[model samples]
Target: MAEVHRVEEKTFEFEVPVVIVGAGAAGLVAALAAREAGADVLVIERDSVPRGSTALSAGLIPAPGTRFQKAAGIEDSPGLFARDILAKAHDEPDGDQVALVTREIGPAIEWLADNHGLAFSVIDDFTYPGHSARRMHGLPQRSGEELIDALRQAAEAAGIEILCDAHVTDLWADATGRVLGLGLVRPDGSTDEVGCGELILACNGYGGNKALVAEHVPSLSDALYFGHEGNQGDAILWGEALGAASRHLGGHQGHGSVAHPAGILISWATVTEGGFQVNLNGERFSNEAKGYSEQAAEVLRQPEGLAYTVFDERIAGIVRQFEDFRRAEAMGIILTADTPEALAERMNVPSGMLAETFAEVSRLKAEGARDGFGRDFSGVADLAAPYHAVRVTGALFHTQGGLVVDDAARVLTRDGAVLPNLYATGGAACGVSGKDASGYLSGNGLLTAVALGRLAGQAAGRRVAIPASA
Candidate 1:
């Protein structure tokens, strides 16, 4: 809500064939795609730097049947990936959106690697909660910072002009919702009007807006808002104001294991690879294998709205590839103990109860039994002495829903007609997550970000020039 205006009264200082807002993963990828299609692109970023929510993620994008997956000897297809999403969502989402993203994800990933010089490698070691295959692709560092840095480098190399610190306050359009230009408010109180042949809204969702979060995702109203400050729902608000249809506004992505106070994301790999969560009462709550998105609320619903992630040194070695975990280790947040009692002592929880919890977990895993909460302990390794634990709290990461669009990433009016020359991608568009945070499978954000971004850019690059009289 910084300002989303339909003010059509501006004089143009310059123009581009394609203008993209919010130069994150989505916007930058869109610029690249447009450039490839022979369009001159301008990526306008709100921040002085280009890092947005993409810098706050694990930089993982799930794609099926990619070269990375093939090299890992993992068999996966778009059908199986779609099935995993539908099965894990537990509620109905847009079937068309699911199918679109699944189909485009593989091609998008390969395109970035083959054309843009992004060194993507599949996470072949372990799978996330709801994913059956090792399809998570990331850069060498496996951090969102590296991801955004690479995308920015790629955009710069493509000669895409990314105007930084020029806050886009108004979107200019005619009565028909056909975009004419955008008004940018600069730092010195000066303004510049830039005409565009086509516009792409890649501004992220409304997680940082407390009023919107309280209004939509009330469950995370008091949770930690960990998204970028620029995610003020400008695209969503602007699209809605322009009579665009929106859906699932209450949906979002949340995390249960962000290191408390430290504020770095503890990769969910710690849980999916056999670690578990327990509250201050030294009791397991929901099945930890359940998706991390839902676990945010579960962790927040605990006694003190906090929980602990318990893992072994072996699991620590597995997750060390993440820059966040390595940072936590550097900060001494990953406490270690030689026994359950000792670990509980370090955590200041009841030693007796902690020992009992560990014993129960070991018994269940040894016997290949299922817990009451429906998490199967079968075939999973048990945590031994020299265990590692981190105090964590739940956090609201980002909103999942926004303006509704078709498979081609065109913004649709409430009447189901396409808005000419305007598109929404990334958090501006409705994501693959179905209804709420619980339905967010891992990598759904970046999957749709790159996939829809490329689609929108390609479509925008091919759009016809605006009529002279408008």
Candidate 2:
């Protein structure tokens, strides 16, 4: 056995049936499931509880074909959801993991509502970019905090031990490469070791770890400006130490840029509002009527990977019409100017071109186009000035690519063999992100995280342990 270092101040060991490395959606759900299976669960989070990627997110949970949908007269199934996700995967996602998520999503949603006090309001037939149907459900808190709150309550009531600010620095195993436990660093910088029957890594991606970001996704070397502060990719590295292989290490799931002050992601809202996105040259780029992800990609292709959304005084009404817009903009998502020329000047785009584009949009509307930026643009309210513009660039929420796993959420090696006692879920696992070619389905992340977490949690909990000497 490797030398186990003991903590001086507290020389104690707590053995649990399972040790979960992250406290985000995946880790918490895993803990919940493990406890349900009668396992003593220890959840070690790098940050305070409910303080990771999920907390910073808009809590859009997408699980197709539920009581919400059935009651609303919408017909769907896990098979249809799976098919749509696979189609979106476009051959890039791990086929097995995708299948697993589709299978377990319904149960996961049920679990959340039934056990975790997660109250959801279903938007009847509301559809995102890549999804075929409007099956996405928004959480009550409308933020990741709500989901975390529910998960935390359930886990606590289940007697799960949660260690916040306790970072697991390494994995501990026997000489035979049989997994044993983890080496954790407490918040005080002192390290301690905890042994467990199984270790679950739900520590999220390396969006904030610029070094890791540069190492994995070099394309965004300098572009990795924002993400959860604690997302240092410890989970991936710890898995590697245990001989686990990971994919899409540096892959980026781009988010639409949040505005300057509020900096809340606003891709969806921007697209929904009749906003015109102008490049640095003041030229309209992309099909504005398209999804936010597509718009974000278009923005990232520009100079400095930045653009501006120009709108007029009517933006106030539009903002009122769409709560997402108001929330995002009120959170510093919108950059307003009193005049079109001033807005153009502030955004550094050509004033003449912006004026011309605005005029063209008006002309197109007059000509019977439905909306601006290649939509019908007909009969829509023209953008009357008191114009405003907000700077936008492609931001990233999380990467979808990760360690390939089977339908059971078992992590697989490059040769396709499963890593013994290993499983993965959440953004840390490979997914069908860009499968849609246009973009991924909105709320896909949460959907997959909760579903796969439950699946992996149950599977890991049920896994029969091999004797240490065997």
Candidate 3:
């Protein structure tokens, strides 16, 4: 671990109505909602606000039933969303946290679009394979930075105080084992204790810290992280030290076919549906019509656990229209050659096998066989010369595990006891999607982050600041 500069002993005393750890999507939402409910909220972050994974993500807000849904003529309900989420949670997930996310996702998404001025379009639910509903909500800005900026702006306008570069090293519990405050190590090598009426943990996942990754998520200990670099799982560690248990510790979505080398995330919409993906052997593997989650697992099944996308000048033009092209090129999956045989050689595959693979693809395209990809692959197939290949591989997204919380977003311990005054939401809490889907559910992360964050904020406000006392 890098030695972060800690501030000196400073007793910064404030009657903080709520202390929020981590200013990512979940934390930001919690802070904003809590403040709007008339609580003096403070958000302590390890990094500058608007710089966490939430800031770096594609700003796709997945609200099931909103004005946007009506505008797009899509049918959905909170109940349906909950059913899909619960189905996934049944497979190796924390049941309580999953339930919380499902119960509140619709309302949370509505809150963002309604209260936060988030411009979004309700298309079919972002379809990970196995999803029954077309439930993905896409943002006009299409970047996590926009969402972060909007959330932070809302929080600031509501008179919330955001402390940046303050790493939360430990949780401050009362004598009765209730969380009261936090131990903050600032950037200047100084230490300060900030008191709070309630604490909300939203510090995100442990993908960035190798040691923590091994300690928690053993499945992907060596897995590459495609999210922000600041998600080090501090909240999880602190919660564990204070006798809080976690779920899905070694479990997360292995996002399929990210833009390699560029470290940017591209929706599976583009790769599985838009681009041509192949295995390391320079041959097409699974049916491209499957969901990205299923495609990601098949790709990992390769000898090197990676795949590549091969396209011609025609597909290249399509890829160029998107801004994530740089990332595609960096991952070594996107390469160009003069002919099919040469392209195969560049990827170190059997030349004859490559030729046969392309021939089979051409035959399949001509036949117009349904591959179950819906309409996303309507125009794909049938490519010409100037071939290109993009190395597609799986990457660890948010962990679907952490401190368990109920539908109200209250943290629950191993023995089913509610940890009073301590609430958790977002990636810091366990994910709602479980084994029901092959990969992470498309919009569940954002959904739970906003929904559970709101629930926690509201509950924390009621618990910490009583109306009678006020």
Candidates' RMSD to native: 1.9, 4.8, 4.8
- Measured by lDDT, the strongest candidate is 1
Off by over 4 Å in 2: 1-12, 288-291, 294-297, 301-305, 311-351, 362-389, 434-439, 464-470
RMSD of 1: 1.9
User: Model 3: per-residue lDDT, tens digit, 1-470?
Assistant: 32122233324465586999888889988987887677888898887555687765666656566666777677777667666665655545555545556556666777766887766665542344445656666565556776788788877777788999888776556544466566678788998877777889887877788787677555556656767677777767766665676776755656666655555665555444345566766666676545554455566677687777666766555435334564456555566888778988888878787888787666656776544434243445577777776566767666656777776777777777877778888878877665323536667677778888898898887766676467
Error of 3 at 258 (Å): 2.4
- Report the CA-based lDDT of candidate 1 relative to the real structure: 0.90
The alpha-carbon deviation from the true structure for residue 197 of candidate 1, after best TM-score superposition, in angstroms, is 1.3
Write down the lDDT of every candidate, Cα atoms only: 0.90, 0.68, 0.68
Which candidate ranks first by TM-score, i.e. highest? 1
Return whichever of 1 and 2 wins on lDDT. Answer: 1
Name model 1 segments beyond 4 Å from true.
2-10, 464-470
At residue 136, candidate 2 shows an lDDT of 72
**Lowest-lDDT window of 10 residues in candidate 2?**
1-10
Instruction: Give lDDT tens digits, candidate 1, residues 1-470.
Output: 35445654556878888999998899999889988888889999988999999999999999999989999899999989998888877646788888888999899999999999999999999989889888999999899999999999999999899999989988778888878898888888898889988899999898888889999999999999888988998998889878899988998999999999899999998887788999997788889888899899999999979999999999999999999899999999999999999999999889899889999999989999999999999999988778989999999999989999887799999999999878999999998787798889999899889999999988887663333464
